[model samples]
Target: MEQGLLVVLNGLVYGLLLFMLSSGLTLIVGMMGVLNLAHASFYMLGAYLAYSISTVVGFWPALVLAPLAVGVIGALVERYGLRPVHRHGHVAELLFTFGLAFVIGEIVPLIWGRLPVPYRVPAVLDVPLFALAGTAYPAYRLFMMLISLAMFCALFAALAKTRLGLVVRAALTHPDMVAMLGHDVPRVFTLVFGAGCALAGLAGVIAGNAFTTEPGMARSLGAIVFAVVVMGGLGSLSGALVASLLIGLVQTVSIGLDLPFYKALSALGITVDVGGRLHDLWLLSVNRAAPVVPYLLLVLVLATRPRGLLGSRSA
Candidate 1:
């Protein structure tokens, strides 16, 4: 029971982390129709920025400064890099962002070197929060959960209940109408893009210490972020949340299980003959296959429901 609970909690932690990263992309794609392939680069930048800032000022300050810096960079990228290509349509925009992602990927290794940095959890949050089912849960994980939940609430309230949210949403479907109403529609786009990048940055800041902070971190997470966005629906925040939690739980549960492929199949009344070449494949344990679970889920979702769980429009 305790182990099961631990797995669930771990899954939630991971799911929320994914949400933090993907929510920004959802907003940008949904609102501006710009894919921003370099989105995960912003996440990597945040982690590196936080690492640098924390080394000088401390983690608390880095937590605020790093994301803000990333937001500013994102805004600049939109204003200068993406705006010119916008006139050429989405293919141009996609190509530009893809190249931009590549550039950022190369630059990071140059700046930070091709190695993982020592971005450890702050000492204050390194202790256990409480015992669950006789297992100790780290306080930092709880902190991460709280931050993610708070971000969701604040983001939801801002979009649904505030004037800016109204304007942003209006700009999405009716940019001309919004512009005619005395709003700078282009400026709105810039802000939205920046805000989205900032969210990705914030995810890096929090997750860097929790996980690993290295050059390849963005590449590792980039695919999963897109998967979550697609599975949750392209621009649906609520869908993203649901999809994030679902993927998180699935991956965690898979890792926690120790059953081998052949045995698992046998328990389901399916039998497969194990041969010399495929014996190792049949003997693969669930824990060893956990990393593949999200992609499999993505494939299933795309095959069955291409529009995603809560997405209104088909991709």
Candidate 2:
């Protein structure tokens, strides 16, 4: 029971991190209809930046500056690179972001080298916050959870309460009407894109030490983020949150359970014949199959409710 509770708590922390990374991607898609293939590259950039900045100015300053720097870069990319490709349609935009991701991947090695950087949690937050069972939980992980929850609340308030958010939402369904009312639709797109990137950057800042700051980290995590978005629905922020948490829990819990399939079934008194036909099934362990859970959930979600859990049918 203690182990189960511990895994659930850890899963919640990891899920919030995924939501932080994915929220921006979903926001851009929901408001601007742009699918950014390079979104995770920005996340990698944030991690690297946090590592470097923290080395000099300390973690607190890095937490503020890294995301701001990433946001500015995002805005510049939108204004210069993506805006020009907008005339060619969604395919062109996707290809542009894909190419950008490749460039970032290649360039990361040149800047940070091929090794993982030493990005540690700050001293103040390095201690154990509490204990579950006999295991101590890191203060940093608790901080991460609280910060992410705050971010989610702030984002929700911005979108639901603020004037700028209203304009962005309005532009989504009625771009022409927004333009007629003298709102700058193009500028709104750029801001939304930048804000999304900022959110991803913030995730990187907090998650760098936990996940490690390395060039290949983007490639490792990129697909899972996409899966979260897809399983949540293309343009749904709330759905992304739900999917992120679900996938995070599935992954964490699976990684913790090392029992073989046969044993797992037999625990419930279901005996499988492992002598011949079902031998392979008996050999399968949860740890070995952990990485595939998210993809499997994606397939199952897509098969049953094509629009996702909280997504609209039209989405």
Candidate 3:
């Protein structure tokens, strides 16, 4: 029972982390209509920046500053890298971002070195928040939950109740119409791209210690983040929130389940040996299939709703 609860807790954390990363990716894809493969590279930049800054100052300062720095970097990329290529169409944007991803993957290790740099949670946040059924829950994780929740709430309010949100939606759904209205849509796009990258950067800072400050970590996890955005429904903030929380919970609980459902089936007169990676031959299919959950969700959701759950209603 305790184990089950713990799994749920961890899953929520992971999902939130994914949401933070994917929300930005989904919005950019849906709004900007640019599938940036380098989105995860921004996440990696956030980690290395935090590591460097935190090493000199502190984690809290790094958390606040790194996203800002990454945001500036994203804005520059939008102005120079993406804009000139905009006229060439989305394939160009995709290729550009893909190239940028490789560049960042190479550059980060050069700047931070090839090691998985240590990212200690702030000393104040290092202690356990509480123990549940003999399991200690780290305070930093709880802090992470709060920060993520707060960011989600702020994003929700901004989109649901503010002028900026309405403008962004108008731009996303009707770029030409917004421009006809004299709005500088390219500016808005740049801002949106920067904001989205900022969210990814923020998640990188929070997850640096909880996960790793490694160069390849972003590459390993990039697809999953993209998967979450696709699964949650492109450009839908509510969908992103729901998908983030749901994915977080699902991944967490599934990975920790110990029930060997397949292994136990023999007692019930059903038995079969599976052939796959030895890593996947588990009694519990959830544990075996843990890493691919987001992709599965992405495939299922896209099959049913290609525009995404909260995507713009096509004319």
Tell me the tens digit of each residue's lDDT in model 2 across 1-315.
Answer: 998988998899989999998999988887777789999999999999999999999999999999999999999999999999999999999999999999999998999999999999999999998888889999999999999999999999998999998998898778899999999999999999999999889999999888789899889889999989888987788999999999999899989978997887798799888787878868799778889999999999998988877777434
Better of 2 and 3 by lDDT: 2
**Highest TM-score model number:** 2
| Per-residue lDDT of model 3, residues 65-155, tens digit only | 9999999999899988999999999899899999999999999888888989988888899998888889899999988888888888888
lDDT string for model 1 (1-315, tens) is 777888989999999999999999999999888777899999999999999999999999999999999999999999999999999999999999999999999999999899999998999999998998888899999999999999999999999999999999998778999999999999999999999999999999999999999999999999999999999998899999999999999999988779988888898899988776789989999889999999899889989998998998897
User: What is the Cα-based lDDT of residue 298 in candidate 2?
Assistant: 92
Worst 10 residues of 3 by lDDT: 274-283
Candidate 3 wrong stretches, greater than 4 Å:
261-285, 308-315
Candidates by lDDT, descending order: 1, 2, 3
Give candidates' CA RMSD values in order: 2.5, 2.1, 3.7
lDDT of each: 0.93, 0.90, 0.83
True-vs-predicted CA distance for residue 246, candidate 2, Å: 0.4
